[model samples]
Target: MSQIRLYDTTLRDGTQAEDISFLVADKVRIAEMLDDLGIHYIEGGWPGSNPKDIAFFKEIRNISLKQAKIAAFGSTRRARVKPEDDDNIRTLIQAEPDTITIFGKSWDFHVREALRISLEQNLELINDSLVYLKQHVGEVIYDAEHFFDGYKANPAYALQTLKAAADADVDCIVLCDTNGGSLPFEIADIIDDVRKHISTPLGIHAHNDSECAVANSLTAVEHGAVHVQGTINGFGERCGNANLCSIAPALTLKMNRPCMTEDQLRQLRIASRTVYELANLVPNKHQPYVGNSAFAHKGGVHVSAIQRHPETYEHIRPEKVGNLTRVLVSDLSGRSNILAKAEQFNIDLDSKDPVTQEILETIKNLENQGFQFEGAEASFELMMRRALGTLRHFFSVLGFRVIDTKRHGDDNPLSEATIQVKVGGKIEHTAAEGRGPVNALDHALRKALEKFYPQLKQMKLLDYKVRVLPAGRGTASITRVLIESGDKNSRWGTVGVSDNIIDASYQALIDAIQYKLVQDYAADKKE
Candidate 1:
């Protein structure tokens, strides 16, 4: 099998995703990780787009990547403009990436309507753009914007667009499913047709509007595409682009196509998670391949089957992609599930222990009250500790009160909280002001406890997420708060649920703090 080149456009196209933004530091960090993951090319955003992108190109030039070539993305020169004179093309040259990718119109509709130029002029633009870039860069990848749609509308014109690049001796011509509406079979047939027309190496850049980006991309490869362009976790503008996490495993494990090395393939989940973490996005628990639920077993039968023969219920070994098999405790879970979860936490308990049964019943009861332990592993661990009589009572919250006030039409509202806590039989009271009620509560609680345990200073809240269980449940519905806390070494997530939003947040916040203290106690014992 021939090796497929993986081109990640997360810094470029992936940033087009709503709410996704990256600083120069983030782009450099992600590029390094992608290189470490054995990606062949990393599209380091368009050099002419924004100041941040420009800064990224400047900064990335200093870092020496081991395996991947950095590509700067831009569009072909305008219809009437000379490629050398075009500002976008000039910027790409200035960025000095050895590889440059530029998109030109393949659709006749775009030629006649979007670019408002004759068909001949569009072909000239494509030729001139690649011809000019070829001189400055070692390799030029020509992306045919809306290529599949163009081919469907006017195959002759689409073929002409690719022919222009091939005539200019471009290294690669990418067929882009820009609108993301093309199906897998359609993409396969079109790629077959495209292969018949152009001898240049073909690539596929697909979007996920039809939820077939990964399938379409894979189909294109199976048909003959040598290059695959996508983003981590399928992040892009509308539905998203093809997910490289899904594509890489499918290609390497299923198709027998070599994309990354065996070691690099194992780093898929870590890379996916790192990208999500840097983007401040909550990972999709159910995302295929790298998601939290990808290998998680909930049903008793499935868990039992997995324990006996993992291949019976699993498609692949969980560790193959740097993931682990998760046996969640729920109403549907059996003794095997409890034992598995306990083993992960290194708890010594037999499946037949009365305490294990009690914990299972408690989980079921709490889940009945809309508490999901699956997403809140820390909270579940703490619950088990409490049940098993090993829980460390770091501190007890006596009570907390929040006061909000705004005077004289002031734009900023004042939030204050007074907290009362009992630490090892000593009572401490503290009051603090913060930007919000939760912030105030956090400040007051920390202030009261920091004196007793200075190690609390090392831990801080990393992220806070709140979700109302069901949509349209209104203000009276139950709210679940998941708080992510981290110190110098590790991070943990704890969950809290309540009808009152603040109370839910408080529960998560306290759990986060207590979890930190528990770690401290365990470390002390180890010492």
Candidate 2:
């Protein structure tokens, strides 16, 4: 197999996903990241569509990309308009990209119903647009929109469309599964047949409506397609486009087709996460290859086997894609799970020790009470350290009180919190006001502790989530709270459970503070 070209459409088709939008600066940063990852082509947005896209094209030109060729996307000329006269075609040249990619109607149904043009007129549109772009741009790619459906509807006309692009001397012709409804067998069969007629290099662009975008792209490659187009994290309209995160690895590791260097492949998770962060969206932890849970082992049997040999459970090494294997502790965990987690935290433990068994039983009981430790490893670590008599007592909470008052004509209630804590026999009491009860409590706690531990001032509560366990009981349900806290250096998660929401929040907040202090104490001891 030849080296497959990796083309990224995250900036163009990815933005079509619902609730996904990026600033111009975000696009530039993503482009630079993609280039660093060894992408062959980076498709910027259609310059004629929106001002933001136009600005992205303008901003990206100033940045020096390492390896990728920037391509501007647009549609072919309208039904009878000359290619030079069409605004969309003109904007592609104005964007000043190294390459131009234009999509033309390939399905007879789309040409007749969508474009409302005759069959011969559509052919003329494809030929005229590509021929004109080839004259101005150094490279031009032709995307056959709905190519699979078009081939199924009228194979002769689909071949004719490719013939038009081929005669224009385009760089590569990409077949798009625009509706994302085709299966792998159909994709393989169609590409097999298309290869017999078109001499130009072929590419595959798939969408995930039927949840086969990744499979379809792989199938096409197996059948001799050279170029693969997809978005990072599979961001696109409706079901999303093919995920390059999965495709890139499958090609390099499984198919024996080298699309990127091993080092560049290691940055896969970082690139996937960076795009999600810029989009302001929570990442799908279940996503393949780059997700947090991708290599995590939960069952005791699986954990034991993986500890002996990672290949027993993992398809490939997690570090190959910048991910790590994690052992989660819960009611289902056994001695092996405890040992593995101890190894991860760099805490020495013997599996035969009775304390290990005791800790395991405590975790099972806690999980039975709805205290989950999968996402709150910090809390679990502190518990283990306390059981082992290795944890330090930074401070003890004496008590805390929060009050909310509402009066007539007041749109919002006033919240205040009073906190008392004892640090090494010194009592500190403080009061603070905030927008809400939780915020007030946080402020009061910090104020009381900052005098002794000034480092606490650098910590911020990044996220807080509450889940009511065994729902339908309404106010009587047990509430589980998870708090994410971060300083300038790192972040950690702590969890708490209680019937009272305030008490649950307080428990989680206490764990967060204690974990930070413990980390600082350990660093000081090492020094």
Candidate 3:
């Protein structure tokens, strides 16, 4: 299969996403991650756009990369300036990239209206920008902005625009769906038409307004496109750009034309996660290759078949995409789910054991009352242990109160919470301030517990998430909390469910701490 180049714009277009922002350091870290994932080209940013991109380019040089060449994305020289003198072109040159992609007007309307230049002047910018960039970089990719629409409106002008860049010896001419509203059939038709005219290699840049970005990009490649441009996790303007996560897999796994290295396919999800985490936005759960929910199974019948044979329900092996299969526990769970969920905790259960039946019974009752064990693994373990009489509590919650004391001079915005507890034949009290009463209460609870087991400090809350089940069911219904925690290398998860948010969170928190202590105790026992 021919090698296709992947141009990642997570730093440039991804940052343009609504409500998405990443610090310079965040951009650098994600770049390194993409490099490690073996992506060929990482469009670091449009340094000519703003100071953030400037700072990103400068600071990122200090870090080491694995297999990615930096590319700077920008437009061709302005309508009135020489390509070499244009600030955008010069900035793209100075950014010191191995490659530069500059978009030029492919539409007559953009030439007459947007650039306010004669079609000839616009064509001059395309050729001159490519020539200048070729002098500064090893590769120059020219994007034909709105090429599909332009081709439909005026095929001669659009083909002429690409002819100019091809004559300038640009490495790739990328057909951009600038408006993002083009259909896949239109993309396929125009790319075939353009291919017949231009000898230069074709590339694709698609947007997702009609939700056809991925489809259009794939269609282009099927016809003869060589380069693909996208952002990690589909982060971009409006509905976002074509998602490289989907594109890479489609090209490599589905089409057998890998745009990147073989190893890149393995670290794909990790790469997606690194970008989302850096942006501080939760990764989409249904995102095709990398999502947490991608391979998750909740149905009892599905879990049983998977237990007997994995091929019954799984489409592609979860590990094929760097994700693991998850057997979720819910109120709809049956024996298979309980057994599978227990295995995740390394707990062995005998089918005929009385305690096994007791555990399932307890789960059903709690779930009927409003518990979602899938989110609260720790709580499930605690319940299982209680069934087998192996669970033990260090202390019990006597009372937790938030005193509405006058906001001190620098009092916390959230209320001050104090926790009182009975332990070791005596009552202990502690207080702390946090962003919220639950946070304060957690600190105080941990503070109190540390007196008994100092090892509790090694524990940390890695993730905390809450959801109200069957919303509009009123406040007295079920609330669920999922908590994932770790010491350093090992991460364990737990779930808690209750009618109250505070209660659900507290249950999940305690389960997390207890699970950590259990692991610590086991490690010490081995020692």
Identify the candidate with maximal lDDT: 2
RMSD in Å for model 1: 2.7
Candidate 3 ranges beyond 4 A from true positions: 60-64, 260-262, 398-435, 461-487, 490-501
Instruction: Give me the runs in candidate 2 sitting further than 4 Å from their true place.
Output: none
Q: After superposition, how far is residue 105 of candidate 2 from its true place, in Å?
A: 0.7
Give lDDT tens digits, candidate 3, residues 1-527.
Answer: 45888888888888888988988888888888888776788888898989998887788777777668888889988877898788998898888877888888999988898888898998888898888888888988898989888888899999999999999999999999988999989988888888888999999999999999999989988999888989888999999999999898788777889666666677888888887877778788888879988888998899999999998998777776688888887766778887887788777887777776677788778777667765556667777777777766667768887644556778646657677777668788888776676677678788877888788887787787887888677877678878887787577777777877877777777778777776777688889
* Full-model lDDT, candidate 3: 0.83
Ranking by TM-score: 2, 1, 3
Clashing pairs in 1: none
Question: Residue 168 in model 2: shift from native, Å?
Answer: 0.5
Mind giving the per-residue lDDT tens digits that candidate 2 earns over 1-527?
56899999999999999999999999999999999999999998999999999999889888999889999999999887898899999999999999899999889999999999899999998998999999999999999999999999999999999999999999899999999999999999999999999989999999999999999999999999999999999999999999999999999999999899999999999999999999999889989999999999889999999999999999999999999999999998989999999998888999999989999999999998889998899999999998999889999999999999987675799999999999998999899998889899999999999999999999999999999999678899999999999999988999999998889899999999999999998889899
Which candidate gets the maximum TM-score versus the true structure? 2
Give stretches of model 1 more than 4 Å off. 398-416, 435-437, 465-480, 497-506
For TM-score, candidate 2 versus 3, the one ahead is: 2
Top-down lDDT ranking: 2, 1, 3
Each candidate: RMSD: 2.7, 1.0, 3.0
204: Cα error in model 1, Å: 1.0
Q: How many steric clashes does model 3 contain?
A: 5
For model 3, where is the 10-residue window of minimal lDDT?
A: 403-412
